[model samples]
Target: MMTAVAQDRLGGPDVLYLTRRERPAPGFGEVLVRVRAASVNPIDAKTRESGAFLGDPPFVLGWDVSGVVEATGPGVRLFRPGDEVYGMPLFPDEAGAYAEYVVAPARHLAPKPAGLTHVEAAALPLAALTARQALVDAARVRPGDRVLVHGAAGGVGHLAVQLAKALGAHVIGTARSAQHPALRDLGADELLDFTEVDVHGAVRDADVVLDTLGGPDAFRALDTLKDGGTLVSLPSPEDDGVIPTAAARGIRAGFMLVQPDPVGLHHLTELVDAGEVRPVVAAGFRLEEVALAHRFAEAGGVLGKTVLTVD
Candidate 1:
């Protein structure tokens, strides 16, 4: 048996409780991971509230994991029993990473970056993959392009800033004044104080706009883009008019969902090893304190990711 954090019903963080369950064994092409750490994300809280992705109770919630492989199932040739690995497995599905053990497909994970500890590596998968996919794959951000990232100090935004910089794009970030110094150090060329400035007016003619804020901000971001620029919305736009609005402006706009990709994870690993990127772990809680971790993440203003360290 292993300790797992699960919710009996969909509601507030209080619904989360620890329970003992039979250890899950890896299936074909999968490996059993002894989780060392996992990160909490807004999706975990949202799903806990509405059961959006999960249909019923007694389901584990978490996608980010960094750990060592304990065992492997048939046809799993990528990793051995002691390999240190990390990934966001079965995302938008039940990954059950917030537990002492999880079964993941071998290809969905990559080697843990040598520069990062388990806690720090736990912070990378979902957020880093989201940022990398949005900027590199979807938007095709290129060198010398003027790229603007909304909500720049938050989870995905901070990584986007560094990635845009690493890809040679000129990156601008929008965040509260309090987060300016960190964003600057992350290589954001300009920092816009969204709380104090007219964000749309402060910037214009960006080659690409990465909208992590969503809703009205996603629509307004179109004004900051050039005629042929692209706007990638990481969050689902609250309004349905985003597409039509972008079409009218001769700009391309779309939403993105991060997926598990070995290629992308390998790229991130390379960047981490090269010192161009790093994970930011703002806080960590024990496996039993998952409810507190969710509540803390929901309270907002956390500079990086909140993680649950499994003992």
Candidate 2:
């Protein structure tokens, strides 16, 4: 039997409980991984609240995984037993990463970088992929372009700031004044204290804006961009009325849900190896304390990711 944190109902962190089940086996082109670390994301808490993404209870609530390949199933060629790998697999669906073991498709995972530990690697997949896909694919950021990142101190935001910088854009970030030094350390060219200033007014004519905070906040980001600039909202791109707003303003805007991208993971590995990007693990808990981890993540304003470790 293997240990996992699961919930039977949807509500708050209190809904979570630890249970044991038979270890899962890999199918064709899949591998069974002994999970070492898993990172909690905002989506996990939101889904736990609404049960929107995961339909019912008795489901696991994690996507980011870093572990060792314990066994490979039939026809698996990408990896073998004893390999160290990391990925955000089966996103928007349960890969059951909050467990002691998980089964993932071989193609969704990439080798763990030598420089990063399991906890750090686990933190990178979801947030980093979100940042990469949003900034590179959705916004198409380019050199010398002015890029503004909303909520630039949290997991996705901090990485977005750095990724924008890595892409050669002049990066501007909106964060609390206390987080300014950390964002600056991540290569943010300008910092806006949203708590004290009108962020839209302070940051005008940005070539691209990465909105990690959605709803009215996303709509507010439109004014910070140039007429033809792009706004990439990480949360609820369609429901926020961003499409029509962008059309009315002659700008481009869309929501980006991160996917499992091995290529992007490899690119991130390169960046990490080159010392250009790193993940900040703000807090950690044991596998049994997943409910506590979720509570901490839901409380908001955390500097980076909260992770769970399994023995």
Candidate 3:
């Protein structure tokens, strides 16, 4: 049996409890992983507490996974037993990577970058995919572009800033003044202290704006965008909203939600392998401490990704 955290009812972290479950076996074209680590994200917090996406309790709460493949199902050709791999498993669904073993699509899994350890690799999947999708697939951030990233020191923001730079864009980031140095270290050309300065004034001439805020007021921030620039929102935006104004200004906007994509994970592997990107782990909790991890994550803000170490 594998140990995992599950909820009998949706509420708070207290509803989560450790329990034993039968070890999972890989399905066709999948790999059964012996999990080493998993990372916590706001999605898990929202889903677990509200049961919004989960639909019910007694469901697992994890997506990011880093582990060694212990077995493979028929038709799986990408990995063999004992191969170390990492991936963001099926999202808004059963990933169950919080347990000792998880079954993931073979194509979704990638070789953990040689430079990253299991714990570090565990922190990258969901956050990196979010940033990568926003910048590359949605905004199409390109060379010589001036990009602005809101909440830039948080889990996904930190990586987004670096990714913008790696894509040859000049990146500006917004965070508390205390986090400016950290953002700068991640290659942010400028930092906006959201507490003191107007976020719009801090960033002008933005060729691309990666907005992580899903709050109702975030649409107002778009007024600062230049004509023909792009805005990539990480949240589900309202219909007939940001788009009309963008079209009027000859600007483009993308309401992008991240998904598990094998191609993207493979791309991330290259960036990590070359030291062009890095995963910052803020804190790690053990499997039994999953509740504490959830509590810490919901406390408002964290400098980097909060992770749950399984083994």
Candidate 2 global CA lDDT score = 0.90
Evaluate residue 123 in candidate 3 and report its C-alpha lDDT on the 0 to 100 scale: 93
Give the clashing pairs for model 1.
none
lDDT of 1 by residue, 1-311 (tens): 99999788899989988889999999999999999999998888888998867878779999999999999999999999999999999988999998999999999999999889999999999999999999999999989999999888888888899999999999999888888998889899999988899999889999999988788888888889998899999777446898888888788898898999999999999999999998778899999988889878888775788999999
- For candidate 3, write residues 1-311 as lDDT tens digits: 88988888888888889999899888899899999999998888887877756788779989999999999999998899999999998886779878999998898889998888899999999999999988999888889999988889888899998899999998888899888877788899988888898787556678888888855434655775788988888756644677887788888875787889888999999998878899999899998999899888878556788899987
> Against the unseen true structure, what C-alpha lDDT does each candidate score?
0.91, 0.90, 0.86
All models, RMSD in angstroms = 1.1, 1.2, 1.3
By TM-score, the better pick of 1 and 2 is 1
For model 3, where is the 10-residue window of minimal lDDT? 214-223
Off by over 4 Å in 3: none
Error of 2 at 235 (Å): 1.1
In model 1, state the lDDT of residue 137: 95
Q: Which candidate gets the maximum lDDT versus the true structure?
A: 1
lDDT of 3: 0.86
Please report the candidate that would top TM-score against the real structure: 1
